[model samples]
Target: MCQTRTVGEFAVSAGDYSAVVVSQGAGLREVRHAGRLLTESPPVRPDEKPPLSAGLVLAPWPNRTADGRFVFDGVEHHLDITEKDRNNANHGFVRTVEWSLYDATERSVTLGVPIGRHPGWPFDLTLVVDYTVDAATGLTVTSTVTNSGDVRAPFALGFHTFVRAGDAPVDDCTLTLSAAKTLPLDPERQLPQGDPVPVDDTDGDFRSGRALAGVWLDTPFTDFADTDGRHVTTLTDPDGRATELWTDTGFRWAQVFTADPDHDQGFPGRGRAVAVEPMTAPPNALASGDDLIVLEPGQTWSGEWGLRHRDSAA
Candidate 1:
């Protein structure tokens, strides 16, 4: 079999912080603070895909679209099935498509791609992603999507990046989120099985934080508890050092996972591994019309999310 060839790799840094990003899918490969890892160093090959979707920008639609089917404006549409075993359309097509690296700087880089009408996806769209590193704030990612088609187009966004606090194992760390409800997913397809249920005592609860020791979560969370409208999720090691993933109002939904060995698929690292996915809409949004974002011709949608690390001051 022919292997994939990745190109246009770039690096940016500021004040002892740095990141490596690639042009293929404009995916982020690594993030570090003071030369220590703040995110998982996904073992991506020279020309292979990033396993477990690590450090990739998911767009157009994130997660699974059951059976690759959805209806828009009274018209039925079918997406190309990528997740064959589940017979669903996964992570949109852009994750493996090439994006133009339009601009770059000592501390930032910008890339874009234009998508035209396809069998399953009918609208014309353009996506621009900007990765910026701030000396005091770490890495910030901004995504702007526009509908260039004549008719109204629908889509949602999600980012897949695994976080770590210092060099601690995820099992020795704590995962925290300020979400009120959890979207119950079926054990088989990993698709929502019903309306969201309160997380008060459920396994998905991470509000006040919980040890990730043996927890297994492949769930989407919503109804956020935010700080000044900013929703933040944190992974803290035993020593109080922390790495955070924060999103602006645009991302009202999030997906969290505990990469249990049985369900880990290909997530990197040993011990409990975790992924905190910020999504603009819930999984299968296209099929359910749940929190889907629609854009008219020339309309643009934008959102911001970032990764930053804080060292224990003690």
Candidate 2:
């Protein structure tokens, strides 16, 4: 029997926008604009994992930690190395876990999950994610995290969602990012190397918007433009139809991934999508203490991110 039948599913609709939120990890299952799919998340099956962490929330920590080990305060803590080949702890372990639907309505839903003290991560936390759709603003996600443990906790966040403009393949689309720098990764571990490098005049540059045709990208970008205190990225079709993702002051990084079919790593729907992830910190943050967020007991941290769409005609 398919276990998906037992999982909770919630939907919100307003105007031309509709979204499906799943119970597992409070991940988003799908989003559509005027009956057209806007994201890459397909309906999840009972025994299957989401394709490319689609519509999933990466929390507690984002990206990977080398060797799954980090020295916090004065103690050495070890996390499970989920990426065996790279010997690193990949995205946080909540995607497969279930979250409780605390509230739901026709245009919004709120899901909550509790994190207990575990061997790898010893901090206790209670996270609530609220997904809402607007008639004019499209979809907005607000996440709140409260430290429930007696001691302080280290935390970071990332959101995984791929956007598409119409049915065209990603190679025909243009990507415009409001970032000035790119984090270079080590060839072997694929982890961030030194400080970020300027993207201006380089292949990494996409300031004025660039066609993704032959560009291979799997990079973390920062130095985001603070226009009106918001950072934005857009993916557009040749005809001008577009989808825009915006992050608030809390997000300091954005990782862009092009799902190439030729890559050795298997990716569902490869060569068809591009993921523009809003992240609070970059890879190996847990070990570097760079841009990491630390919360004391009873403290709460919150942030927001969202997406909007525009038609070719207007």
Candidate 3:
């Protein structure tokens, strides 16, 4: 029998706020405010992996890159087909790898990983993720990527955090997105196949705020309507308790999923949580050359996003 040893875990706190960041993918294990849980943090055994992405720091490429292959500078590269069923390279490479603690304080911690030239992704880059919390601001996550390779690297970034407001069922909550349009996905591959469609006159129109009840969503929305360079998506319960996930202008897209319990691969607390993933680009951006971040040698790019609780129920 073989065993996998635990990597590392860091818990940061400030006043009544706290967060747990695990080394494996530098994922956020837990987040709470004033001793009240704001996100679902499932218990993982020493040898087990965090299931359903949970609170993952996606990098290099956020979503899928069809067939795990892309062309750059007239050269074609093939990535490992991680999602065999879909024949795509899902997420990026760093999620399953351990990151080293770069820095830490009483209320914040930073993790860094050096992505060497490897199979599929043949670019040398350093990714750093900083998690910080304050007495009044909740948890703030910043992800930065620096290109160390001789050539430019095609990249994209995103964050996966399953959010919840107290104990309310996700279906009973209301969702408000600042998106003017959304991409319609291909049912088989779940990839964006055509130009984005306007959210007007459709079930996708969340501009006026809509009850998430009975509305199934595993969709990506863009054309963000931000105010003062900040974009926000909020989920509020019937009692008015709400959780807001905001991002900088760099994060132009967001994918919202209503973890359905009836699905074949349901999340841990299915039907009770929603994952509002802040993404830099839509799925298969590598192939489409759509909004993909190209990091030239010695260049760095960074973005910030975070979760804040509004306790209107109190």
Candidate 4:
């Protein structure tokens, strides 16, 4: 009689870590460490949409496609514009759609969906988002995309999650990112406007870690100095407790945004909150063909990004 829950919540736990992966968009809903919140999640009614894309999967292409138009493989296509104010196609088709439950285990849950929602995106691809969390290691999310179509398909992947360090005010938290440069964005459309800039004196220069009090950004940082296989970023509260987010080589870019409470659009928090997003490519990858992953028929692209909660707050 009643419609299905907007996003079915699948709960998984192991040791001191627990996570809830929703069926909608195969997105993450909640993640906790030792009963303390590790990621920021807004309260939602069963019929409500997930706010601010807090834990949605960004795929096919991340960010926006200007004018919802692009030419690829000598073919011209126009996507259905989702961001009318900017006249662009924002994110992709996966966020608000329902995903099939692929598998579930004590510590992990996998959800999947086939992409090709619009006539503009005519290639068929399957996506599997696997989420795993444990007390010893926190949470690890692996997104595997397979091309199941006759022709090659362009693709990229990203995950949006807001993190906090033990209930600390976001303004007092310090961020350290393992990035060497920042891509400038157009104020009007939030699209790439110029070449990447060095992080030296810019707000992007959080290499040594800096207070986020005065910085307001929705910028992409690239040129990761990943000495090891993993690129890392850290958000530390004033008292020294921190959360570490890391991405594997498949993910070469990260976007950091400062969400304001004065605006209080969707996110449910008192003060400023930081969204550290793991992205395979920067914005407008679909249009620029920059760092886009091309998956031939039967080919797949696998990438991982995760968070580790340090319990020093105890």
Off by over 4 Å in 2: 1-6, 265-270, 312-314
Off by over 4 Å in 3: 1-7
In model 2, which residue pairs have backbone atoms overlapping below 3 Å? Answer: none
Model 2, TM vs. native: 0.95
Model 1 lDDT, full chain set: 0.85
Residue pairs clashing, model 1: 4-47
Q: Measure candidate 3: CA RMSD.
A: 3.6
User: Model 2, 13-124: lDDT tens per residue?
Assistant: 8999988888887888778889877787665662356888878888778788999999888889999888898999988867778888788888898989887766689999
Q: What is the C-alpha local distance difference test score of each model? A: 0.85, 0.85, 0.83, 0.83
Query: Candidates' TM-scores?
Result: 0.95, 0.95, 0.94, 0.94
Q: Give the C-alpha lDDT of model 4.
A: 0.83
In candidate 3, position 196 carries an lDDT of 90
* Residue runs of model 1 more than 4 Å from their true location after superposition: 1-7, 264-266, 269-271
